[model samples]
Target chain A: MPEGPTLAQLGEGELIRRLGAFAPPGQFDDDAALLGAALLGGRPAGDPPLVLNTDVLVEDVHFSAATMGAADVGWRAAAANLSDLAAMGCRGAVGLTVALVAPGHTPWAWVEGAYAGMAELLGSHGGVLLGGDCSGGRQRLLAVTALGRLPAGGGPIRRGDGRPGDVLVSTGAHGISRLGLAVLRGEALPDLPAAGRERAIRAHRRPVPRFDAVAALGASRPAALDWRVAGCDSSDGLATAASCLAVASRCTALLSRSDLPLAAELAGQAQAEDWCLWGGEDFELVLALEPAWAEALVEQLEGARWIGRLVEPQPWGPLGWTEGGGPIASPTAAFRHFG
Target chain B: MPEGPTLAQLGEGELIRRLGAFAPPGQFDDDAALLGAALLGGRPAGDPPLVLNTDVLVEDVHFSAATMGAADVGWRAAAANLSDLAAMGCRGAVGLTVALVAPGHTPWAWVEGAYAGMAELLGSHGGVLLGGDCSGGRQRLLAVTALGRLPAGGGPIRRGDGRPGDVLVSTGAHGISRLGLAVLRGEALPDLPAAGRERAIRAHRRPVPRFDAVAALGASRPAALDWRVAGCDSSDGLATAASCLAVASRCTALLSRSDLPLAAELAGQAQAEDWCLWGGEDFELVLALEPAWAEALVEQLEGARWIGRLVEPQPWGPLGWTEGGGPIASPTAAFRHFG
Candidate 1:
């Protein structure tokens, strides 16, 4: 577009050839295009139906950059929030990355490693870096926007899709990450006889995103529920996710207090309630299924477990504690930022 | 999306129901979408034509978090990057945000201010925040990726678009931001005229994106030449921009040094050469056109002047300093950065 006899090289009023070169992942588009960099003192695109979501991660709140590897920081920076798109049943199209660099040069190796890690992650997934801004400051923060496609006819899996007696299932085991965090923080002992410390550690290191499993399930099975944003990752604890989901879903879940899955270390730390209910960063697929299909679905997924069923939303009571599991509220008070 | 359902409440299959409620955007799209988060893990929607650009701004590299208000930081962050998007004639569809938080707590007021600022900019422009990552970090850094459209059939605008006999025109005047920066630095300005200070400061503090202007110029007039990715930013200084543009454009520009516009105070501060070619952050539109259309375009853009015409590219003299006016070699010696 810029290399040819368009714009200045040609005269005004002459038909500028269409910029059909930069191919993006949006199949809906027909040609390649030229990108105008950041707002360059110009008019904006016309209003269109758009989706928006923003996330802010604070040190200690999200990750300790000091303790975390640079590459891990990069990977997590993109993956954590990207999971939201998947949960929304939206296909990611492009990425808008903003990295607020911290003061002092981050080692070239570290910076490149982080970018390399993120690039590898983004590349393997079919995403392109559209354009973004970079700056330095007190802390290193990253804001990434994942532009995605709404499945053509396929709708997004929304929170209001659960049916009465829908059997609850999760894509994989849970509580390991929370336990891993506890182990890392020295709050729990993974040194116990049954503790699989290595497994717990791996769980914390590189969390996997469930785009595949979710997409396959969406396309092949088409989770026929009324909502589309379906089956996204559950990195946070089950209870935390449930609290918000319950309100939107307008349903309650009752997990058999004893049936939730947990690693042996987590089970041992059950007394601390640091594993199953409150512990987070699980990053698994938690699902709601029709009661009729529960057994077969569980059978189909070897590692999956039926935790509870969706009931009516409750004003009070355990939403998943024991078939009456309502929500989690620490006695002395819910989880606080500080000790 | 999180507000409606718990993972357990609605299983993975219900995405269709939720997403179907919304309409898809016009243009390109494919079913295979970017599936994962780390380095592009999702399926492809199929490649569509589009434009892309990115930039990063930090608290210090771009602005001092200490003195600059959070709202200003946020406004500038989006605006500065949006400028890149505008340069390419791209429309912002989605964004990826990575905010590395500082130690302890940065007030919610600050966060709100930042989002409010960005929101105001994005809302007016018609873009959205899809999903991004957040983490704790040492210093603040922002990286943004912008995705845009190019009339359904646009090509990459490279620097090599200009040709000999082309006219030079910009959307607006130059050197205001430099003046603003000088003001911010509180430089001795007994000789500095007062008229240009406020405007320059505003230009530096908030650079409105040039997307609309570029689009309008490209659409209505259809640029005679492109020189897009091929060209750099005003932050790099007009001289460097001209040099690189002319070189890539494979042409030389006989710019009439006298005709170039400069803010009054800026003209008084230093050598006119600095303001003419080396001054930075002007955010003005620069054009090279055939002589015939130059007059018409000049009429279209009131403030523009006959800078110079294009000639064959030279290894050292893209800007025809030997022919007459312009500075030697000074494009800010590259933008300053702490890292």
Candidate 2:
């Protein structure tokens, strides 16, 4: 054994917090780092800011051969990073690079399938595969770095931009991906129909990055607000996303349980509400927008739901219930890597 | 066992070649991918192209606890990616993101030390840590994505840009890192003095990215020749670098054995020349430039040496020897992943 506390003792969140000290302060506060003229220094004024997001998926940690095929594994890895770019308000990605590590005994066909899957996704979206590196290792791992450009003349929508009166909206339903994972694992879900089960499995296997939501948000932005929307993806669950927004913006997020956008397939399921609040890898955009803009967006955009609102900061933590009017306990910790 | 062909059967190069089909043509030919207005569709004319490189370092495969501690592993991982950026002729990096994977039992102190090493290198060079991801894995791994920008009005120094008459120059000596690795492995070398052993050990542990050579090359470029220098870092040894340049440029590289820039530390060592030609992890640059400019740079840049020249393509392969004027056998393949 080594001399100090192991990563399991600290957990992923704490480990990330500790590691954040090595980077520029506040650079890790958002889904992606924005490299703008201000950051690069001496760039021309009209050039759009570049958004970068890196996500790593490891075998047995993020995927399993038992549940996900090589293609699905590749799709999820790319989606995770592209979702981060979307969360940072990029309309589309410029390109992505993949750093892959696999054991020597791994199939070349598997590697080709993964790249094909990534190509399929990028073809549907608007980016190309740039380049990457490969190495042999004990376990299969994929680290994807996605590069995107913010819309011309548009500022990045940051987590810290939420205001007390901003309305919280979810771009689409949650719990579907969790249901999909359960289905793939052969779990019994009595309330879910066969079609619903298939949808859930597909959702888990190939979660879309919600660029449509980003477009809707951009299109619905009131001129006065000037691209000040605040948002993040619900990859770590709704509660965590809300908490992050609230904490970063120094306000309290008041969510209405009745307004939670649980997937139709999960209706009346025993763990539906729980999954809606805490299920990971949903890949939906959770946004805090001006009240009027949120109303317009929800009415105009399919599946958009007004789920919550931001309130004045309280002495307690950043999460609260709109109905009970007090702080809500944090959701059960999500699936942390080392926990 | 799982497929028709395992990665080991095809080797890293063939695997990469197959993977290359999924990317845009010619994107993977260089040390780094250059994303410019042409590739990205509609960037402003004045904006410089962005250069991106991703490098992955796996424990046991890329580093071992026997030879490298946590800090050295991190330093080498970061250096490898930064060297790619330097090879692309970037004066410095914009920033880099690290995707780290380690076991749950990994010491938190080890993780901290690794990040510290990366910070130290980035501090000495010119980039900041933008952001990164962390996960639990069976083996420790680091995937770093480095971002840089081509100089305003300057083109990327591509491997394919060598001209027939260009003289090949090496920025500094090679083989020190290979010697260092041997020393760390407890190999006996009577010819190497204690000082040489210490230097070799240091070289292996913390090889610097030759951004200084990049700067010198930039400064010594003749206005008539523009920025048309063809180069790559000697991370995979001099022979591999020269071969890559020659093959990519469709010319034959005629190297003079008498002019090889072997490290002074290995002056009388029996394997000195072999190490200089075939040893990996030497981060010095191998560049092909116009003869006049090469001579100017060799004089202006300390430790620089004119090692060879590019010649007309032959019916044989791209390598040749100046002494005999016939094809030179390809140096034994360097350390390749999955080989």
Instruction: Looking at model 1, give its docking quality level.
Output: incorrect
- Cα displacement (Å) at residue A44, model 2: 1.9
Question: Backbone collision count in every prediction?
Answer: 198, 1
- Name the candidate that leads on lDDT: 2
User: What is the C-alpha lDDT profile of model 1 across A1-339, one tens digit per residue?
Assistant: 222331222221121111111112321111111122232123233211222233444445566754467677666666655555555554554553433343344344455555655665666664554333334355545555555444544455455566556667666677777666666676647344434666776577556655564555444442444332323356656665554345446677666666676655554554435466666676666666665445555665556677776677667842656544445554343343221
Q: CA lDDT of B279 in candidate 1?
A: 62
Compared with the real two-chain complex, what DockQ does model 2 have? Answer: 0.84
Q: Per-residue lDDT for A132-199 in model 2, tens only?
A: 99999989989999999887745687999999999999999999999898988988788678899889
What overall lDDT, based on C-alpha atoms, would model 2 receive against the true structure?
Answer: 0.88
lDDT on C-alpha atoms for all candidate structures:
0.51, 0.88
Query: What DockQ do you compute for every candidate structure?
Result: 0.17, 0.84
True contacts kept of 2: 0.89
